[model samples]
Target: MKIDLTQDMIDQGLTCPVGKRKIEYCDAKEVPGLYVLVTSSASANSSYYLRWKQHGKTKHTRIARVTDITLAEARSRALTLRREIATGNLTEEREQKRKQQMTYSDLFEEYVTYKRPFKRSIGKDIQFYNLRIKARFGSRLLSSISRHDLQKFQADLIKEELSEATADLYLRLLKHSMSLAEQWEYIEKSPGKGLKLFNPDNAVENHLSKEELKRLVDVLMSDENRPVCQIVLWLLSTGARLNEALKARWEHIDRNKRQWTIPATNAKSKRSRVVPLNDTAMGILEQLETEGQHETLWVNAKTGKRYTTIQKVWQRLRLKAGLPHFRLHDARHSFAAMVANDGTTSLYAIGTLLGHKSNVSTRRYAKYSSDTLQSISNHASDVIQDAMNGDT
Candidate 1:
């Protein structure tokens, strides 16, 4: 039903008829399909909308609130919308504009929600966003972000004394987020395309020597550092990541088969792998099995809880062992180095033992694998000896 709506009618208030209280809309008398939408609250002002049928489908578009626009203005806007609908152009243009206006904060929120359930590193991503990305670019429109803005951001991070690697990580996260935005069509294109990453200084690869390993082992064997000792030993033996070892559970281990399974959730690569337990790794598990009543394989004897970190204890232990500074990750490197140095093991075998997802990562230890080099040298020496003896 259509009724001529005036300012007085709007100001004095128009109520839905008693029998039509369930209806949400009342149409205008002059403008067909133009409506004043009513709500359940009597005090609430009605809003203007246009509802029309085109090609057997209903299209509803909001005009404005009663307080914001006069009836004449609503009629004018509704007429324009009607023309656009007849021409078949308004809806897609309106939605495209809305997507082009999406801001960094908007995309980040959606990204976090989509990633939280599936991504293991989302916590770190959130930390990176909060600490660095949010404050500078959170409110900025995604379409407005440019290569220059990213370059400036990189310079700012460097000026703040962030290491090149850390600064690159921030840029990488931004690039990744923007890439997602592009994939989701929140932005037309990724602005981070063709951005050059900062070249980080060469990192020192620390591998413990036999003497140093002995000293470190002795220090770890002390009563106070036993929990950390066992953890480090496991790390050394299996070449598993620190977190993988810390979070190991008895259920994931098959002692009789001499295998320990690192669940995909607990692993960096998000792929579950079975690590063959060496004699040393098996021994540590057996000792812990006898001592631990809980389901977790590695736990603090004193607290009977999983060990979160051993950084503090490790720092002091390394100092007492008279070893040069080395991170806990270096233990994994040392394991790879030891295996690679053994004359029989191939780099592929070493990579398999370390549970590396790709051979590219395993290639870093090639320079440290003396076995291959030794074999090449021995072959050359044999050729030279054969020439000297006129055997060839």
Candidate 2:
């Protein structure tokens, strides 16, 4: 039904036919397509809407609940939306002129700063942006970025010999930033949505062979970066993450209990967990304490600060060991693989020792046959046992 909508008219209340769902009362005097829907239920909320046709189909956009705003406000918003729909511009010229376009670099700076204080992987975000993303999209205007631009960037990553996983990481950061930009009103919508992620699920854990383990150990023994090497050793022997090992302090460990308590603040899961220290790990700790490598567990003997990253030292060591493809994180995987493949430890037990919150983390190694697992377990079985039992 057509009527001039007013605060007094709506205040009088409305009703619909007994069998009908709701009724529409459109404003004929002011905004042509503006309407108010009054449902059959007396207590139900009545909503204002603006109706239009697109591609030979009727469309309706809700303005607001009648009770939430005055009649004047509803008409004003409806008229504005009508103009936006007709012109394909959501904002008025005054608004467009008031805000300058933000470049990708501007977004990157603001994004990193916003997330830096709490995000654990903020370092990688900065690294990827500076190393790859900034070169391509740094100066590009946020308004000008499209799905094609992102697609081309993804292709270039593959051409440059970057793996799909690495490309995915870069794009994931960019996409999330774009999403935030959209939320912040830099754009109408995110271009990153529906950009197909290139990497597929490959959950296979990287396990070091007997010879590779020996080579890594040999390299660790001779390397000048003794602190980082010990960190790597700690990761391998205890199945702890790099950050966990780096942030560990003397107070967190109990020699008599042979267990280290990871504080909730430092842990990835943000929960305090106690991991038993193996004989090998305990030996490394005892040596560190004797030498007084600060109060922190792993530190640069030369600089007297805790090792923030083992990447630089790891690169040199991996190359010297002729295992350039190996990553420091792979040491933890190798540790899990060793104990899991040995057949003595259950999957749940391995998850607990690795401080994994669930079995899914250890489930990948569960697929290997006994023969395949036994070969991988040869070197680290004793060390893993030491971790489980805290004794030889």
Candidate 3:
């Protein structure tokens, strides 16, 4: 069925009959353009589409509110669109030009300045977005972005010897940011639509071995940097993100309940999170609570100021443990892996503790076999036994 559209359709909205049909024509003042409505199935729930093209070579694209276009409005829109097509004035290129004025950096700056300050993961996301998008590709207009551009970025990252996972994260960030741009009408479409990202699921596990973990823990305990030591141990015990642990405050803790409440303002998902403090975590907090004079729980020893940089201390500890390539983030992974092995915590709990916003985040830690799990538990058991046996 083909309906001749008119102004009434645009003003009052049109309902397509229950069948495969198209809008053959439209009236002026009904709509600013012409449309073709397509229904794939007989079911009312099936999506209806409105498609239009600018000129001979321009491709047809989907339009919003296909159902809302009344017959008169549809006809009006169709006639105008036909005239424009005949005159060769309407072009996809022109439409694209209108969209390309907005860039990734524009949206990123807005998100960081306006949306980010209200979220808990602002610091991490700020670093991730700046490094991944705005610092490199952000200046470019969004509509001008193409798969070739992403390919170049990927190739550049590969030349820099960045891992497949790291490169993929950069790509994913682009797609996600562009998706937001698309939603906000900053771009007509997502340029990342056809690009493929590297799959990190095929990558080898980079978790620490038992001896390495023991050595790392020992080094942290013995190091004269007690603040960093406490921070490291707290990270290990609670499986919290570095920034989350760093920005932790005395007010967030409930000593009587042995729980830490991460306010929505400080949480990754913009939702409040409750972390049940383990005995190890509680002990560290009790010790720090007594010593900390600043608003934050973790403080610098030399000047009794809030500590800011743990990078240097982490590097030394990594070297002492004979694990130069290991990242502090792996400690959170180790925590989840160990907990999975012990069967003491659920994957959901582990994710909650680590501020992972999805089940996929915890799933990565649950891939160990029964034997690998036993090994993890055995190491934790041995350490506990040694601690109980008066080993310093």
Candidate 4:
């Protein structure tokens, strides 16, 4: 049936016929595929639609509501859709294009599957996403995320009492994820491009002095905290990282050769290295070897398993030694300082001993090497003065 849609008829509230299978609509007189769709009494408002047959299939496309667009505007839009349908563009193709856009959660899943296998700190990344990132932006579309969104996220992290370094880490991870999204074509470009990071003053070196080191060692030897004392002693002697020493296994050690091989899987650099053990390091390993029943080198006597942490016991030990301000990693710094102060070992040799992947890390100890140089300069001055006084 055909009818000219009037504003008075629309205002009176048009309804569909009783027992009709679908909404009863009247075809417009002026436009071929345009119709005034009268919904059932259950619906509050009526809308317009364009219907046509192409390639043995019927397609219906919604235009706009009668309350939103005028009759003249609906007719014009219907005409354009009819022309596109006649030119072989199907409505299903447009719907498929709309579904192709990826959301932030979608891209994050893909990134985890593709990138996490090779990342050393994948656990930390997953934790950050679950704890904060996913809750804030998971449902948002990838293209919808902007630099302002990332800036706000950084601010939120700071407001939550996270340290500046930690907040910077989270922001960096988000930026990295977005970059991966772009590489995989999920996004056109990273929204977090050129975003500023919090300035973390991580360059400050906190090392122990000789007197402080001696006191700490004495306290560790005297205290009942055997596991922490052993771990701290191992760190001081071998310069091994905390995680590396904690995960040490019996199979990797060679007592006869006085070497400990850090596997690529457990190493931060993801490359294996053979760490030569000094007499002191060898003694600690011998003690552990006699005491440990499991395959792992370091095991908690109480749990009969690998020691996961020594944070609390280490704090008490530091306090007992009167070095309450020192951190666990200061032992590593002390090792580098001790080696650099000897005046004989080159910076490259010190770096090799510390398992440093790059010279940039070892160069931080150059300041300690000045002590050795100053001593040599003083000795030379004394020798020159004695020769001049001899007058021979």
lDDT of 4 at 255: 87
User: 2 or 3, which is superior by lDDT?
Assistant: 2
lDDT of 1 by residue, 1-392 (tens): 56667878777766666645424445556677888876554324456888876668676666766666788888899889889877886775575687778899998997786566557789999999999799999999998999899999999999999899999989998998888777556777898988899867666779999988888888877746666888988888889899998888888888789998999889888789899999998778666652347777767766768888888888877788887587889999999988888867878898888888899889888888666788889999999999999996
Off by over 4 Å in 4: 1-100, 130-132, 152-162, 203-205, 224-227, 289-293, 372-392
Pitting candidate 1 against candidate 3, the one with the higher TM-score is 1
Assess each prediction's global lDDT (C-alpha) against the native: 0.81, 0.81, 0.68, 0.80
Ten contiguous residues minimizing lDDT sum, candidate 2: 90-99
List, residue by residue over 91-174, the lDDT tens digit for candidate 4: 666644643577788877866765554666788888988999999988888888999999999998989999999999889889
Q: What is the lDDT of residue 390 in candidate 3?
A: 84
TM-score of each: 0.70, 0.54, 0.56, 0.63
Identify the runs in model 2 with alpha carbons over 4 angstroms from their true place: 1-106, 120-144, 159-163, 200-233, 264-272, 279-294, 298-328, 344-352, 355-363, 369-392
Residue-pair clashes per candidate, as listed? 0, 0, 26, 0
Q: Which residue pairs come into collision in candidate 1? A: none
Q: Give the deviation of candidate 3 from the true structure as CA RMSD.
A: 12.8
The whole-model C-alpha lDDT of candidate 2 against the native structure comes to 0.81
Number of the top TM-score candidate = 1
